[model samples]
Target: MTEAINDWMAGFEARIADLQRKSADLQQNIAASGATATSPDGGVRVTVGPTGALQDLQLAPSTTRYPPAELAGIIMRVAAEAQREAAHRVAQAFAPVAEGTDAMRMLQEFLPPPPEHVSDAPVDGLPGVDDIDEPPQPSTPPPSPPPPAAPPRPPRRPSTQDDDDFEQPW
Candidate 1:
């Protein structure tokens, strides 16, 4: 009986190992395919690697007017948003490999909770931590453009010949 039990445990351990290896591979794939997030209003943009490291930032000209404190706050918020997006994307990209298993749960261990909701819904059904969804599509179609207009030219006026050419210093 003891020998039989050992054999069963060994098989279980091997199965777990196989699952773990597959999970690691899925993670590597996700890391290779990265994600980025940017402020729609063009205020800020940030990119994060799959490992959640800060990769890059681009700031709009308008942000230059902000004081250091305010700028820092905006940067922090933007970075957080970017990171959240990256995490969500990673989870999503790996979903195919992660579904119906514990892999997705393991992936969540790497991500910090969102500021408002602490649930792990993003990767709940995937094999890895889910990547954030891409921002929603714009609702309305672009407005029909008006016909192009000619550029305006400055108004011209005739000069009077009797106008004084010189003025007194006093």
Candidate 2:
């Protein structure tokens, strides 16, 4: 019985040490993580830390051409992009520890969804413009003729009554 208790105690100590090491690794990974993004026009850049906090911002000299409102909008967009990237990095860093656990779901809930892209192509598997055998002719309907002009109206005849006929006694 004494040997069995010793073996159990050793296993418990090893588990505790392993847990501590993993905790340290996780903390290091989170501390070292950050992400950056720039505006499409390259006028603004933003950086965010692992917890999605803004860390830095940079603006190009040419950004002065934009109005204050426009500049502010661009900065907001860039910052949001950077935060999303940072969130993704943090999620990846925690993935190993969070696997097969509810922590992954909770982490995903805190992150923003990926951006959606718009495509001009047709939904079906039809050939595109370049693959067409012949250009499609526009099927515009014929324009209706203008409405017929209204008939002319007869002229009004002058009044035959005189102003003296309308006079009344006081």
Candidate 3:
């Protein structure tokens, strides 16, 4: 067991060294290339240092129309999006050295493992089903066929109350 642990530790140390070297490369690339990320709406621009620090920000002219609080919100949202993109780029750049290492395998542990086996037993008779005695009830018998509806009323004829004032011009 101790030998197994030592082996794992050795692999872990190698992975760390590789990550450090990759980080150095990433820093150099960032310094040379000066990565810039922009918001989807093009309303904000963010510049980052090689070590992933915010270097600068540029705001669009249309942002002035918004109220002070709203404008601050917009800027914050845009900056957050740009920062995420920058971090993604950094991760992607480090992928070459980090892909197959123990560190990557450790990350994979966070995901739920696949089921070892599937049972053929029915769900209705499961052990906990008895605890929940209140099964769903059906709707009220289709409203009792709507009480056979009321009989239709007869149409009324027009009244002769206004005919007395009319003149026949035939």
Give the best candidate by lDDT: 2
User: What's the residue-level lDDT of 55 in candidate 3?
Assistant: 83
Better of 2 and 3 by lDDT: 2
Ranking by lDDT: 2, 1, 3
Q: Candidate 3 clashing pairs? A: none
Residue-wise C-alpha lDDT for candidate 2, range 1-170, written one tens digit per residue: 99999999999999899888878887888887788998766778898888778889999996776667667866876787788888888887787677768989898888898764322112233323333564444457789999999999999999997768746663
- The candidate that achieves the highest TM-score relative to the unseen native structure: 2
Poorest 10 consecutive residues by lDDT, candidate 2: 118-127
Against the reference, the lDDT scores of all candidates come to 0.67, 0.75, 0.58
lDDT of 3 by residue, 35-140 (tens): 5766445666777654446789998885555567655655565455555555555555555656888875664454333323322112323222223454433335
Candidate 3: TM-score? 0.41
Model 3 CA deviation exceeding 4 Å by range: 1-27, 30-35, 105-170
> For model 2, what is the alpha-carbon lDDT of residue 50?
85
True lDDT of residue 82, candidate 1: 72
Q: Which portions of model 2 show Cα errors greater than 4 Å?
A: 116-170
